[model samples]
Target: MNTKLMGSALIISGTALGAGMLAIPMVLAQFGLLYGTLLMVLIWFGTTYSALLLLEATIKSGGGLGLNSIARKTLGKGGQLLTNGLLYALLICLLMAYILGAADLLVQAASALGLELTFMHSQIIFTLTTGVIVACGTGVIDKLNRLLFFVMLASLLMTLAVLLPEFSTDNLSQVSNSDHIGLIKTSAVLFTSFGFMVVIPSLVSYNSEASDKQLRNMVIVGSIIPLVCYLCWLFAVVGNLPAGQLKEFASVSELMAGFEHDAPWVGGFLSVFTGLALLTSFFGVAMSLFHQNSDTFNQNRVVTYVLTFVLPLVGAILAADQFLSVLAYAGIILVFLAVFVPLAMVYKLRLANALPERYTAEGGNVMMVFALLFGGFLLASQVI
Candidate 1:
């Protein structure tokens, strides 16, 4: 049972660590280790707390309904619309980022294999292939996601191990010209790194028979693994690469190009690993989107799959080639759906006596205020 739960944990961790892993070191390099570590720790605790609140709510709802449906019952029509709309937007934006990341990594991998495909071709191929796997149904998605996630996670560890002997102490300690503004800016980017909460409903439904302890354990292990992975990734990448070289790339391709120029072997591993990372995330979000739509529309499986898969591909095509900016937007929406909604759901649950006396995530009214403030700070960052 623990082993089975661990796989679910790994799925959430893998989803959280993707796309953002490639950028975290550079983002943190500016803030330096002291501040960067502090911020991630706070964010992890807060997010973990909120995720448990979500778990409690999921458990209380008795597993028959999806998130939006539960919200409709607990939070009325406005809450339902807010969650349904923003959550869908968040997943679509995340899907777009993954598609873009995959295409870039695919081009690099193809060149190494001498396939020589164009960017457009790679993106289309990746989208269509992943789409088919997703359309197979949620069960297929669960199996494939586990396989891809562990592959990606293992490669990341291996890449870091290979690169370890070259790490410079000063590379991590070296101070850059960072200010409050830089930290805030990087925080906005890093905020969405812990976005596995959106998929918690899918996992709960998949393992509908799990106990409260089992559910809590997976959420903790699942979220903490990514938190540790991101920190270690920052340590390895920052300690190995100079600040100037690390920050030079505004894009993943350029960053990967720097890696190849500096260390060709490591770069080769990174390109492949990043590709798998993107695919794992793509599978995770796409699975959640498929299930969410399937439950909402009460439609045929084939139709829901097509609708879920097609929208993101179209969005990716229409979206700008940029990656980080989309994530920043996604983060704002994610915090609301993932972090903020739980506050309301739990508060409502407490008042209505929906929660059992044994529930662990019995959140306070004050926590809701803090969540609201934190979410507002994030929203204000986007506009200002």
Candidate 2:
């Protein structure tokens, strides 16, 4: 792969594989391995297609434009407002999830090392540490994220190796909750895991000289990397812990606590893995949010930095235990930016013949409607 393409692809993968992956086993434990794996692949496909749609629109409008600009060009000011509103909500919710998750892991890691810290203290420490890195800008984030991504990959593999010895095929079949509604709710949260679409426009500008095929391949390759890792993670975790047992934990931190008692070694490796996962995710999402806020508000760098991290930091502090809930809500907002906005932009662009010679996303109206209906069902499933 071209170095630029590979870097961009890594960005997508890093963004997609966050603390969100930490919740997969917890959610999948209720549905069993077979059904959960299917759901993972289904959401992966939907999210990848939506990303292509966004890429098509971005390339057509020229690279480097933010979501607000793309929506404005293709769907007007109302569209811009809708995109901006949803993007803000989705990004902040994700940042809050990462902050809360990373803080919990930080506390755990500290306790293991004979040090102690309150959850609130860990939250502030983790946020400020990672926030400074994000504030350094995208160029720095790209390099650091790539290096951290590799460390995260190593820890994940090591964690899986430690846990796989205890894996049982019988546990994979253990479904304590088979209710479709519960599965739907879990699916809504799982959908957010593949939300690399938010960063596509930035990637386009970052690799402006790349060919269209290179960009498309980058999205597919980047996203598929996480799907493979997630499936392996699900198999390792769920195959070892029965759904009935996993269901009892109130939060992912509690689940991590369970790991510490059952296997201190696995907990050590997992703490490293989960922490880096959240850290890299913070870099990816925070970079985008930082840029998006700056572009939308036309603020100075200090103001944009404050706009990007302050709200999410406050949210993480106040609702430190709402990690899973924040993810579910982010998933709900993701349906709009990841599905509806991309399809809408592409449809309008085609209607205006604005992208006549540009590379179009393969699917036509049928695919668009399928995406809409599918996304709508996921949204409705949340409330009903």
The predictions' CA RMSDs to the true structure, in order, are 1.9, 1.5
Candidate 1's C-alpha runs over 4 A off are: 362-366
Instruction: Report RMSD for candidate 2.
Output: 1.5
Task: Name the lDDT of candidate 2.
Answer: 0.83
Residues 42-123, model 1: lDDT tens digits: 7777777788888887777665335777677778899989888987899999998888888888887788788989877787
- Report, for every candidate in turn, its global Cα lDDT versus the true structure: 0.78, 0.83
TM-score of each: 0.94, 0.96
Candidate 2: misplaced stretches above 4 Å? none
Per-residue lDDT tens digits for candidate 2, residues 268-373, read 6787788788887788888889878766888887787788888998999998678888899999999988899888888888888885787787778888888888
Model 2 per-residue lDDT at 14: 91
Top TM-score: which candidate number?
2
